[model samples]
Every structure is written in C-alpha cells, then in structure tokens.
Target: MQFTKLGAFISLFSLISASALTFTLGAQEKSCFYIFTEKPRTSVNFYFAVQSGGSFDVDYAIKNPKGVIIHSDEKQRQGDFMINADEVGEYEFCFANGMSTFAEKVVDFEIKFQDENDIYKAKMPVQPNSQPNTHVEGMQTTIDNIDSQLDNLLKALQYYKTRNNRNQATVRSTESRIYYFSIFEVLLMVGMAFLQITIVQIFFKGSRKQLV
Candidate 1:
C-alpha cells in the first residue's frame, strides 16, 4: 500500500515538472518561447545547455511582459537562472545564433514555474493526531522524501545526456578535421613530386642541347 501511494505521488510530480526540449537553430536565426504568469511574484526557473555546434555557445535574452529585456547574455555555453515574474502576462525567452554565419546549434533547455500559493497549498498539515492520523502523517513524509529523490535523479539523467551529446559532437568535429588534413597532405606531396620531376627533365633537356 505504501509503495502504491509512493508511485502515485511520483506520477503526479512527473506531470507537474517541466519537460525538457531540444531546439535546433540555423545560422543567423533566433527562436523564442513564451511563458505566462497569472499572478505576480511567481518564480520561474530557466535552464539551458548548448549540446552541439560551433563553439557550443549562443546568445540568450529574457523579456518581461512589457517587451523589455530584463536579462540578456552573449556567447553563453549554458545557463541556469531564476526570475521573479512581477507582471501578470506572457514572458519571453529567446535564443539567437547571429554570431554564427554557417554553423547551426543544438540546444537543450527547460523552464519550470513555481507559484507561491501552490507551494503553500501543497504543504502537508501537521497537528494533534490520534494513532491513525500519526501513521498517515508518517507515510506522507516517506512519500515526500521519495518524490524529492526522484526529482534529483531526473536532473542527474538530464545532465549526463547533455554531456554525452557534447562529447559525440566533439568527436565528429575532430574526425572531420583529421580527414580534411589528410587529403590536403596527400595533395601537397603529389604536387611537390610532380614539380621535382619536371625540374629534372628540364635540366636533362638543356644539357642535351648544350652537348649537341
């Protein structure tokens, strides 16, 4: 019965948590996402990482409901930010790759919103309890602990995924560089050999003419 309740709580937490998303930005392109806050003083958490592409960096901007830029950065590889939503409207988050002329970028990000009222309401009540009530309270505490652990696990998984993607990209870029360098080396050697042969032939021809 305890395990069943814990599973249900975990499911609920999953539904409430923000989902991670992947965004591909073409060269000189900008992408934006909108988040709405119904009440003032809501907490918004923004997390992002550049998983691949040139230099693994991008420009990011956060705008409030009034279309004013509140937070902005340039050539950032990753960021985690918390914003206080003071206005009750749609806020905008944007990512731009204007610095890159031909290299596209792959970015992973997530946004989570926590309302003060919701947090307050979610708190379990503690009061003078009989035997049955005490038992129920203890079970609720265990469920809460499990939920917190699961959330941490989810975050760890996301971090690993980002690292893996970046490593793979690095490997591919290195291989491409090596491949092109090898081709260039071969071409240079062939050109040098041809030049030497031509020089030797010209020398022999001039000598023969002189002898004649």
Candidate 2:
C-alpha cells in the first residue's frame, strides 16, 4: 500500500484523452478507454470534462468487467465519479459524440486507481492507545495531511487547466466567425456601390436623349 518511489505512485493513475472526433450527418463516433484493477474493491476515481467543440458536451458510459453498465450520462459537460471496483478485471469508460453534426468534440479525462486501505485509513477514526509511539504517530499524521493537500492541489490545477483550454478554443472560434462576417460585409457594400453607379449612368443617358 505504501509507495517508496514517485514513479510507483504515478503508475497507479492513468490520464488519457481521445483525439478530436469530427462529426458529420448521421455519423456516430465513440471512444472507449480501459483500466484494469489488480485487486477487488479498489477505489477508482473518474474525472472528465469537455474541453472544446460544439456545446461543450459529450455522452459517457462506464461498464464493469462483465460488460454491464454501471454509470452513464447524456450531454454532460463535466463529471467526477468514484466507483468501487468489486470485480478484478478491465473496466470500460467511453465517450460518445453521436448526437452532434458538423462539430467535433475534444474530451479530457482521468482515471485514478487507489487502494481501499488508503481510503479507509483516511475515513476511519484512530483509536486511543495507552502508550502509543508519540513521535511516529505525529510524523505519520503530518505525512497524511501533506499527501491529502497535494492531491487536492493537483486536482485544482487540472480543473483550471481544462477551463483555460476550453476558453481559448471558444475565443478562437469566435474570432474566426467575426473575420468571415467582416469580409462578407465588405463585399456587400462594394456590390451596392456598383449597382448605384450603373443606375445613375443609365438615368443620365436617358435624360440626354430626351433633351436632344
């Protein structure tokens, strides 16, 4: 349950993002990711957010190792879920963009595997000891607090990063629309000016003929 090296701790968490799926009329696109639990009753943390694309929403589903749906949602922009892995096998997490047309979706997701012992230790009350090792107990408590704070900080940073990316994508899309609209407006004005000049010239010729 204890990890001595940072690499070992990092290995328990998996961060995977699907490539952008370009949606077309009557086209259905789905991305499925899998993570395995080596032990039963492992705590799995699932976090996801739609970073960009149309409506900033996507459908998601999670299935157990037996291929039964455990959780699902439609047109969700973001979610954070914790699942208890009772079965020891690969679990499926999927994203579907079938309902969208002419717009692609970009999704950011993370799956974290945590031992049940750690979860329980954090939740369970500590029993009093008549002659407990004061120094060791104090050190352990401090370490646990630090670890919990770091985990929370990491989540916060990731949440902000996703928001920033989504906002930037929105700005770029708006800029593109504005650029094309300006061009269309300029062409419309030029066409109107040409039509007016032609009409004025025709009127002047008619007046000259009538006067002559």
Candidate 3:
C-alpha cells in the first residue's frame, strides 16, 4: 500500500513539473529560458507559438549544455520539437523578435521532461500473488489509460490554441488595412471635389473677361 501511494505521488510530481509560459518580446529584443536535467538521454518536448504580433512569426533557437546549437529557425510562427538531452546540465531556449522594429510579439511555450527510468519502472510487470496485487495492477492500468488520454487532450488543446491565434491575427490585419483604405478614399474624394470647384470658377472668370 505504501509503495502504491509513493508511486502515485511521484507521478503527480512529474506532471506538475511540466510547465507552460507566456511572454512578450519587444522589437529587436530576445528572451531566453533554461531547464536543468540531472541525467543524460532524457526526452524533452518543446512547443512554442506566436499568439499575436506583426507577421505572427519570431526567431527561435535551442542550445545544449555546452552552448551548442541543436535546433534553430528564423521567422517561424510555431514549432514543436522533441529532443534528447545528451548531457546533464542546463538547456537554453531562446526567442528573438528582431524582424519588426515596432511590433511586439506574444509567445506561448511549454516544456516537458520525461525520465526514461521512470517510464521503464511504470511498464515493469508486477508479480501476481493475492487480491492486493491484482487490485494494484488494475489501478496502475487505469492510471496509464488516464495519462494517455490526458496527453491526447493536451495535443488537441494546443492545436485549437494555434488555430485561434492565427485567426485573430488575420482579423486584426484585415481590420487595420480596411481602416487605412477608408481614410485614403475619403481624402481622395475631398480633393477631387475641391479641384472641380476651382475649374468651374476659372471658366466663369475667363468667359466674363472675354465678354468685356
């Protein structure tokens, strides 16, 4: 019973350590965050999206413990990456907003770490003995199923979030263009009206002078 409780506690702790964050980057500025790993060959999942800003894109890079660039890109609106930590140390993830001089970028990102040993332990078979063993096996199976479902749900939510962000950016861009076009059209109409009035006045004056 104590062992089962301890396993449950560890699972909960792992889930809680997975993190999501949102941040704003000013034009021509860059931001970075770090995660520490205690062992080599741990699986890391990284995800990022530009929630709002000009062009809906930003530059990003992932660096290993030794400052070696593992993955990088420019003008990317969103990305999902899975990497294995080859060394035990700090890993850096950075985002750059150098593409726009005045537009700020809103970015959302998540990082999750999976320890291979924990996974192996979770999959290990249990020795069959009494009712307690059977009960524990059933509980573990249920927990695994729940964890799988949660993972799928998280993916679905992320997809919807990206779609929503893109739609919002489109709407904002269209609205801004429409506003500028309307102002230009109004100014052009006013200018044409003034020109026509000036032409009519000149014609009438010339006719009077000719009569004189």
Candidate 4:
C-alpha cells in the first residue's frame, strides 16, 4: 500500500530492439497506456505511478515513451500505468498530472516478471542463471497447475450450494400440500353429519306421535 515516488525509487535504462520499454495508463479516471513489443516469446513488465498537480480538472501526457499520444484523460487523483518489456533488461515508465492541475496524488509501482517470485530472483544479477536458471517452460507449467486447481475448487463449491437449495424448495412444497389436504377432509366430514341428523329428526317425530 506504499506509493513510492518514481523519481527516488527507479532509474531508466536502455536495451536493443525498442530499448526494452513501453508504458500505458489504465482504463479509469485518469488515463490508459499500452506497449506492443516486436521481440517474440520473452515478455517483461514494470509497474509505476506518479502524483502531480493541484488545481482545476485537466488531462494530458507530459512524456510518452512511444511518442504517439499513448494516453490522455481527466484525473481527480494520481495516475497509474503498466509498461511491458519484450526481452528483459531495463525499461523506463512514467506518469504526470501536469504542472498546475487536479489534486495532489501518490503513486506506487513495481516490476512484475515470470510470476510474482521471478522478480525477486531477477535482483541477483552477478549470479549465474539467477532468474531463468531452470527454464521458462517449467515456470509456466507451475503457473498452469495452480490456475487449474483454483478453477476446480470454485466449480465444486458452486454445485454443492445449488443442490442444497433445490432440496429445501422440494421439502417446503410437499409440506404445504399435506397441510391443505388435512383441512379439507375435516370440513367434509362435518357437512355429512349435519345432513343425516336433519333427515332423521323429521321422520322420527311422525312415528312418535302415531304411537302416542
């Protein structure tokens, strides 16, 4: 949650074929940026942020690495961007809220490569095969396995909940039907008894007067 300043934390570096750097803003309040690299197979990413301006609302790009108006939008807070590097080495990424505009902002950025852990391994440069010591295929395989397990777990939980809800609904319906049937039977029996009593009272009264 610490928004580190790009000026103090990171420095720019260059490499072959596109200088190994491209930056883009997000699809939100401030702006959005994207980098398309020509180098195949290998890919790298650097995350960065910056806080600038404190006045009326405005949107513009101070420096776009690609030099083609990469992104522009009105921002109320700070700006966030993600840059991609196709071959590794060093890449430069930046953001600005103009000199006199918007509210004060804070930014925090980090480099993400291979999976989250690969970045830590990248720090040891003087060592042999520090980052990709084993093989990129192996790292990708591990990531694939982890993703599969997560998907299966989510599916299993969803099915269990759906079945339980179905069972509860069936039980409720059956109980309601039985309750209504019992009430109807009791009312029918009472009606039959009342009719029989009326017929017997009229006939029996005539027989009693003749005997007297």
Candidate 5:
C-alpha cells in the first residue's frame, strides 16, 4: 500500500527530550510520540520510541489499542519526523526494518501531537496483565498534553491569553518584591542621613558652648 508521504511542504522536526517523554501520571492532555517513517508521506506520521538504553525494532502497523494504522512505509527508508498536533485522537504510523533486519535492532521515531491528542504504537507486543507498550503511549500522551500547557504558558508570557490568572499573579509577585525592597532601601538612607546630622550638631554644639 502507498503510505501518505508528507505532502509538498517544508521539512519538520519534533524532538521528545528526555523530560518531555516521561510523565507516568498527572495531566492527560499533553503527550509526546516518537515516529520514524521509512517513506513518510504525511506530517502526521505516528510511531513510538524506546526509553533509556533499550533499543526497539520497528513495525508498520498500529501496535496499540488507542492508535490507528494511518499508513505504512514499504520503501523501507527511515528518518525522523516531527509532529505538531492540534487535535486529540487516534493517530497511526509504523517503523519496519523487516526489509533488512530481524535481530535486536534499534530505531528512533518522533510523533508530534498538537493539542490533547495523544496516541502511540508500541514496538513490543501487548502483555496479558500489564501492557509494556501502554507505558510508552502514556508517555506520548503526557508530552502531547505538555504541548498544550506550554502553549498556554507561552501565551501568558506573550500576553496573548490571560489563562488561569497566571499573568496577573506573576505581575503581583514581582511588584510586591520590588515595593518592599525599595521601601527598605529608602529607610536605610534616611537613617544614615539622620546619623550624619546628629554627629555634626554634637560637634558644633561643643564649640558653640565653649565660646559662649
């Protein structure tokens, strides 16, 4: 089958940094996915990568429940693809070296989800009780959620959107610190001025009294 190649467009890149890839709990809106396209046709190519030192083999179909096999790369050309997701839902893509290898092989993939859309394919097969792949999918979900959070944070910083009153809170905190520090500085200067005046008066008073 002909997998959709990222249409006539600019080359895109999405890096799932170590921190961006791991978040076992908390928010579910953001997630990150690593995808490798042997013949990438769409910017939305979806796949998953391994964690830490363990390298993984590649598959050309959906390896997880929540994901979909949107396309498959048969040409067997592998490269990095960055995904920027705007919606949350099932996404599908795959990695395959069957055209070449069958042993303990290692491949890296990056999938970008714009909004809360978090779905990923697992390199290994599913388990009976615990899903080895679910964890990777979950990590991708967290990363996707982070994208949204990061966007909101950036907007707040840029004054685009005043979300969660974050901008106001930051301004208030900064103002409070500056105000207190300024008051303390002024008070210190005033005390020094008073001390100088008192010393001058004491010295002059002694001279005047002796003259009188």
Candidate 6:
C-alpha cells in the first residue's frame, strides 16, 4: 500500500512540475528564462507560441549549460522541441521581438523536465510473487496512460488557441485597413465636389461680365 501511494505521489509531482508562462515583449526587446537541472540525462520538452504580435512571429533560441546553442529559429510563430541535458546546470530560453518597431508581442510558453531515474523506475518490471504487486503495477500503467492522453489534449488545445489568436489579429488588421480606405475615399469625393462647384460658378460669372 505504501508503494502504491508513493508511485501516485511521484506521478502527481511530475505532472505538476511543468512550468508555463505568458509574457509580453516590447518592440525591439528580448526576454529570457532559465531552468536548472541537478543531474545529467534529463529530458526537457519546450513549447512556445506567439499569441498576438505584428506578424505572429518571433526569434527564439535555446542554450545548454555550456552556452552551446542547441536550437534556434527566426520568424517562427510557434514551435515544439524536445532535448536531453547531458551537462547538469541551467538552460536558457530566449525570445526576441526585434523585428517589430511599435508592436508589442504576447507569447505563451511551457517547459517540462523529466528525470531519467524516475522514468526507469516507473517502467520497472513487476515480480510475479504477490497479487498486490500485480495490482499496483496495473494501476501505475493506467496512470501513465492517462497522463499521456492528458498531455496530448493539452497540446491540441494550445494549437487551437494559437489559431484563434491569429484569426483575431487578422480580423483586426483588415478592419483597420478598411476604415482608413473608406476615410480616404470620402475625402477624395468631397474635394472633387468642391472643385466642380468652383468651376461652374466661374463660368457663370464670366458670362455675366461679358454681357455687361
């Protein structure tokens, strides 16, 4: 019973350890976050999306503890990456909004760290000695399956959220462009009307002067 309880606790802790953050980046600015690992061979999962921005894109980079660039991209709107930490220390993730001059960018990101030892322990074989051991093994398997499904669902939701944000930004930009175009069209029509009236009045005055 104690072993079962301990397994449950570890699973819960692993899931809860995932870190998520949402931040705004000013024009031509950069932001970075760090994650520390105590031991080598840890697995890291990273995900990021630009919720709203000028072009729905930004620059990003991930560096290892030794300052070696493990991953980098330019003009990316969203991404998902998994990497292994061979050296134990701090890893840096950075985002840059240098392409935008006046627009601020809103970004959402998630980071997950998994210890190899815990993973191996969770997958260890069950001895064929007692019924209780078999039951605990089955329960752990069920929990792992549930955790995987939950992760997939979360990723799907994030994808949809990114799509929604992009559509909204598109709608707003189109609306503003249409508004400006309408104002310009109205001003041009008004100027033409004024010019036409002035020309007609000049012709009548010339005719009157000729008769005088």
* Per-prediction tally of clashes: 0, 0, 0, 4, 35, 0
Distance from true position, residue 180, model 5, in Å?
3.1
Q: Itemize residue pairs with steric clashes in candidate 3.
A: none
Specify the poorest-scoring 10-residue window by lDDT in model 2.
Answer: 17-26
Candidate 1 TM-score over all chains jointly: 0.82
- Residues 50-138 of candidate 1 have per-residue lDDT tens digits of 99999999999988989999999999998887888888887877899999999999998887776545552334665675355767778
Tens digits of lDDT, candidate 3, 113-156: 76655643345355667345666778888878887898889988
Cα lDDT of model 4 by residue, 1-212, tens digit: 11222434433432221122223333223432333333333344343333222332234442233354434455433333443343322223335445443344334333333334323232323456556556665666776687668746844553454345445645666798889888888888887888789879988998999999
| Candidate 5 weakest ten by summed lDDT | 22-31
Best by lDDT: 6
Candidate 2 achieves a global lDDT of 0.72
Off by over 4 Å in 5: 1-39, 44-166, 209-212
lDDT of 6 by residue, 1-212 (tens): 00011112221123244777777888998877777677788888889999998998999998897899999999999999888888888787888999999999999988877655554333545577745666777788897898789889999999999999989999999999999999999999999999999999999999999999
Q: What lDDT does the true structure give each of the candidates?
A: 0.79, 0.72, 0.79, 0.42, 0.41, 0.80
TM-score for all models, in order of appearance: 0.82, 0.77, 0.82, 0.33, 0.27, 0.81
In model 2, what lDDT does residue 93 have?
75
What's the residue-level lDDT of 180 in candidate 3? 100
Residue 10 lDDT (model 3) = 25
How close to the true structure is residue 12 of candidate 2, measured as C-alpha lDDT? 30
Name the runs in model 2 displaced over 4 angstroms: 1-27, 118-132
